[model samples]
Target chain A: MTSTETTPFREAPIQPGDLLLSIENLHACVEENEILRGVSLQIRAGEIHALMGRNGSGKSTLSKVVAGHPAYTVTAGSIHYRGQDLLGLAPEDRARSGVFLGFQYPVEIPGVSNLEFLRVSCNARRQHRGQEELDTFAFEDHVRETMAIVQMDPAFLERSVNEGFSGGEKKRNEVLQMALLEPLVAILDETDSGLDIDALRIVANGVKKLALPTTATLLITHYQRLLDAITPDFVHVMAAGRILRTGDKDLAMALEQRGYDWIEEADGSDTLQP
Target chain B: MSNVTQSRPRLWLETLLQVLAQWSGGGAAGQPAGARDWGLPTRRSEAWRFTDLRCLTQLDPTRLHTGTAAPHWPEAFRQAPSGQVSPRRLSLQLDGRGHWLSPQGEPPPWPHGLMPLPTGDIAPGQVLRTVIPSGTLLPLGAQLNGVTPGPSLGLQVSGPDPVHLDLAIQAEHAQAWLAPHVLLVLQPGARLCLNWHVAATAQAAVLPMVEARLGLGAQLEEATMAWGCPGAAFLGGSFIHQSPRSVYRRTNATWGWGLSRDEPFVRQSQGQAETHLHGLAVARGQSLLDTHSTVYFDGPAGRLRQRHQALADDRGHSVFNGRVVVPRVAQQTDASQLSRNLLLSTKARIDTKPQLEIVADDVQCTHGATVSCLQADELFYLQSRGIGRDQASRLLQRGFCEEILQRLPQSALLWPSLQSLLETPVPDQP
Candidate 1:
């Protein structure tokens, strides 16, 4: 239950011709501190990229910044999703554009039932896409089925969103939301944190099932164990808010055994450019 | 009936003096004659700190000389008197002094030992006397109505079986000052469920009070709602006296009154009593709503849980004051009071205070007050899910109010207009 056999989730050639998200020379700040400095990455349709970084390496901030979080001001950067200026769009617009970021710590909304929130949220997305909104009963069946993908209990749907939920349950709930939203570019931030073996399996498998050939996935984690469950086509190591190296899945296993010192030394040896 | 009656004879306007003196019945024993000698409430009055009497006086300047007028039913009330005009289901309408009737023009089937009679036959009982006391505006308004010979109705309950009553109060025109009072006496082991809907449409002043006494081992569940718009002013209060082994539960909701206040006072006589009070006030436009509740534990082993919530937008103002008193004899008392408020607009204001006075050595009393605007992060959380900023705020606001609304009686929850109360768009927080 600890790890799955490394069956490369994306063995076909990466669809570089259909770029979905591209980050070039990105820099972001929260309040007084600069968090994401000169971070650049690109993803194409039908590709899965695993981002491995140490604590405080700015992985979470990069995820939030790309999601158009207002709190994280992109001082000097450019994010393009589907060939459009993503940073210029409002957070909600980005969501409707099919980009979803699974938070490391989902907020607790007291007195708001999970079912109602999800239904309203889905309706908003559907309306944005020029589709008819789903009513309560119709949305209930869809949400119930989606919850099963994450192995969530039906009773959790009746409770407040993330309120009083265990850490693992909250993670699984986030996965359920991702499955329901059906985002084109999904960024899973620390989805492996605070999860048991069974929960990890359910969440990883849920992500794998929801990802379509036209959609891309970004898996951000500190450990390579999650990579085993959902093998990525490419693994990128990040430090000081910038990705220092990129390789195949073995890079994740190598970083686990060799630690981050070798990557730091290698990055210092080269003249890094945005 | 044991309301406020202590007066110090301070020189005041004749209108204030006449109203207080007549209402206090020439100063009852232990009643605060200050109720009379004291002039009309200003911001200086502790109980009236959050409300302005000028607003009420402005509604009817010559109220002192005019007195209560004859019950002139409005066209709206005279019709089939449908729910829109007074939409509460299973309702009894109070047309005038000492008169009560069902919207369908009949009375409810009262359980075994309870009977309904004219207001004249029912001498107002003194149980909730300590709750409202004779000295407040409630007694003054009631006494003013007594001046006019009008119709009134009273319901008497004496059986051990459960009794249920659904009633409503509708005030007359804007020029006349209206005051209506009702009494309920529960016998030992009796159970009573009473729901009241109070509405005033015209530009008049109103003071409505309900006084109830719970006998030993008796249980009572009561829910009352008072709503109005720019033209009306209402001062609603409830007083209760609970005997040992008795329990009292009350839920009060107010919305859109020009100036209104909901006050509750309850006292446990011999301990072992339980009391639950839940209040919600939603105000918009230039409305002002305030709620002040005080619960006292007199004997040993009493318990209380009280919560008050306010949601204000536009240029509205809301106030909440919850006070819990535990005397030395009331050992092993458990009490908690929380006042949660949401200021939804730049001009919206909220004043919340939770006061606890415990003289008992062995008691658990906790009180807290919170006034907050919706967090930016919370809004972003919803907006990030594709909901617009405005829609996201509405969801959060509805969720904030759902805590108490979910606990209200089914009939009140189903009130046709209640949905709009939660649906109104809130201005973004400044």
Candidate 2:
């Protein structure tokens, strides 16, 4: 009944064969502008991975590429989701295969009820897994249960999807969706951007409660404050579209103390024809 | 000119002409003096631009027949009048094969401002008169079946008591033309609610003309719903005249049809008159639907508000032309018009025009028209929730029609029929 040993700063390296997601030298561009240049990272199951980077460091583009967004084209490199090649799948197919992206800016849809939409999305995943579709009552029960986990009001389900929703409410709704979908690999792409301190804690706690032994999470954020709430097993510093340095939780503390300029300086000396 | 002569006149046109000729030979019992001057469709007319008259000329004049037997009316229409709250009074049911009228009530007094339908070579001046006594609430209902090439009903109503007229018309294979000369003369403080339904089958064609005149201080609430089959064609015209201090509200809802057109003309002749017109038209497959409405402010201190919405899918097309005119005499006239269209398919098209002509210096008039496709974000949102793209589109389209459908009087009963027409796969029919 004893809890596992807690690491205050440093943690051991992830053993081989524990990888849940592997992005190999990924190169992606949006339209004519190249955003991601040879980025690579590995996320292990039962562990939280923190991706910290400055603005315009291709953090968002890499998440979009992994989610199979239509706007970002992957010219090279490969993404493996649970050892399955993710590049050949459509965005929706990728979602059906247990890949979830909590969008930074969720789209607003008027005249479409939130309950009706969630039921359909849940059923799609079930259908993809060869399971029977849940009837109305079962679907409503599932939504209510998930709404509780995210601390969202039940009335939000009756309103149009994300229509006229406040910033915190939309972020909470995205987490609620993640809870309901229960994806094996979830990528939170700047979801903490507009959330207040209280909303940020609720969202982080929701993710922490939903994480399973076989589930892996990639928390992409600009600030290390989110990592403080949901401490990651591995922390990676990304600059200029590549992983400049990888360490345990202490690297995040170091970066928080010195800012991204120190990481750029360290990477600059390492790659200077040595 | 050569094309006009070579093209056959419309079958309805030929039937009208033959009926007019027969009535003229019978010494014009109900004919007006200026009948000959009423113009017929020609190549030069703006209304006849998209309609081809050549196929109509091929119809033989000898095919026209007259009989005392009435066409069979559907059971749905026969049972509709029983639901009316008012007492049964003068009622005319034209089943196409024969005519029936309840003999319990006396004729209503004719209103002073009654205007007859303009007669041409095809249509003779004829009027069906029904009179209900003052201080009595009368419920009138009629069912017209247009299965044959020549069948029509002309009805006029006048009385001081409040009246409710429920008219339902169904046309089958052959073409039919109905000119209902409704001249309702409401006394001071009188009120009326008129409900009319016109539906045509795939092979039928129908033309319904409804005209009403309101007295001073009167109020009228009118609602009309028209639907046509894949190959059917429909032409509907409604003319309303408002007296001093009278108020009128009219709503028209249409869906389905091969080709359907509705023209509503409203004129306010005295001060403090108010009128409102709202309509919705939905077309699927290769069907074509159009609405033309005009509101005229000929009196001072008049007000008019009009709004029209259209949704076109598949290869369907919709056209809307709304005009609000304020004359120099209409010193304090206020008018507004808006037309909004949603095109679902790449091939679906909509043409909307909102025109405002104001000659009065102290009048306010405004008009706007917009055509757009379904929002991509909205579609994605629905898809993200679990509904397929097709089902999401249908739901959104139905929401678009809900505004105008709310205005229909019998939407409770008519909604199912309209939904079926919308959901049913478009049949390949010519």
User: What tens digits encode model 2's per-residue C-alpha lDDT throughout B130-193?
Assistant: 1122332211111121112333333333444556555555555344433333444455666766
**Global Cα lDDT for candidate 2:** 0.65
**What is each candidate's DockQ, to 2 decimals?**
0.31, 0.14
What lDDT is reached at residue A269 by model 1? 52
Off by over 4 Å in 1: A1-17, A268-274, B1-38, B61-90, B96-98, B111-114, B117-122, B130-153, B156-162, B171-173, B424-430
Q: Give the Å shift of residue A176 in candidate 1.
A: 2.1
- What range of 10 consecutive residues in model 2 chain B has the weakest lDDT sum? B138-147
DockQ of structure 2: 0.14
lDDT over C-alpha atoms for residue B227 of model 2: 78
Interface RMSD of 2: 11.6
lDDT of 1 by residue, A167-248 (tens): 9999998888888777888999999999888888888898889877788999999888799998898888889988888887
